[model samples]
Target: MTQVTLDDWAAMPRNRDEVSHGVLVAAPLLDIRHQQAVTRLAYWLDERLPDLVALAGVELLLAEEPLTIRVPDVLVTSSTDLNVRRISPSDVRLVIEVLSDGTVRTDRVTKFSEYAEVGIEHYWIVDLDALTTRHAQRP
Candidate 1:
């Protein structure tokens, strides 16, 4: 199979899919609890950080060449313009991923490393099953 590039991923229809290191990964549908978690988080962020915008399930471009694109369950950014479909990591202030059975590994490992590598200021992982939230900040 041919490797997928960021341009190729961007051209495709917006769906529950992500590209990590040029590999396509399918994301499971968000359940009610998952959706609720994302909503609560977004709301909290909006209230606390009025200057930043909170978005759910938005595609973010973390790297280039062998592209890495991720769709965080919740994202907080200062970017006001919505014309761009994919946002650079530098523009993002925080990335939140609500843990689901199908995405635990990717969220905790793959995405964690990717986000850190790109210098994302904050990363949050919300575990609905455990009813907990884990926060990580770049060192």
Candidate 2:
């Protein structure tokens, strides 16, 4: 498998690929329930944080060499620019992931660490199976 850099990942077509530890990986198709959760979260964030931007499925570039990238289900940021293909961790205020059977481990472990390392203030994991939301805040 060929390693992919952040720039390479960004240049690819949207909703097509992701980089995991510098390796290119295909993005999984989101199920209807997951989509619904992301939509609802975006709406809720928009209502509560009018000054910030809430987006769904946007690429969040976390690291450079041995590149790491993740697309959160829903993300809240103060950035106003919509033309950017990838966003830096500094621009992100919060990240939310709607748990699916295929991504439980990555969301809870891999992404959790990456988000924290980048100093993201808030992280939320919504587990549809358990009907609960787990929240984490950086100190």
Candidate 3:
């Protein structure tokens, strides 16, 4: 198998996928509840953060050399990044991951670590199943 670079991942069609530690993986299949939760959270965040645009289902390039990329359920970024191909950690103000049955651990543990390591200022894991949200801020 060949290594997939960030440029390769970026050029691919806008499918919700992830490049994890140099391997490609499909994003969790979002159910109706998951979809609704993402939409609601984006709208709620957008209203509160006027300068940043809350976007849903956009690619976040966390790393470059090893090509770590993830598509957050909702991400808050500057309006200037609205038309960009991928939102880097520096450009992302906040990222929200809506937890589904299959992605609870990923959103909670793996992503929690990845986002922090990538320098995202704020991260929120919304667990719809548990009806709770955990917010983390980088110190």
Residue 50 CA error for candidate 3 (Å)? 1.3
True-vs-predicted CA distance for residue 51, candidate 2, Å: 1.5
- lDDT by residue (1-139, candidate 3, tens digit) is 7778977886788788899877888876778988998899898888998688998988888888788899999999975847677788888888888778778788888998999887887888776756654555452
Cα-based lDDT at residue 67, candidate 2: 93
- Cα-based lDDT for every prediction: 0.83, 0.82, 0.83
TM-score of each: 0.90, 0.89, 0.89
Per-candidate count of clashing residue pairs (backbone under 3 Å): 0, 0, 0
lDDT of 2 at 131: 76
**Superior candidate under lDDT, 1 versus 2:** 1
**Best-fitting candidate, measured by TM-score?**
1
Please give the distance, in angstroms, between residue 102's alpha carbon in candidate 1 and its true position after superposition: 1.5
Across residues 15-121, which tens digit of lDDT does each residue of candidate 1 receive? 96988778898889878988888888888888889789888878898777787788999999889887788777888998988889888888888888888888887
Candidate 2 lDDT score at position 72:
88
Please state the error at residue 47 of candidate 1 in Å. 2.8
Q: Which ten residues in a row have the lowest lDDT in candidate 1?
A: 130-139
Q: Which stretches of candidate 2 lie over 4 Å from their true place?
A: 132-139
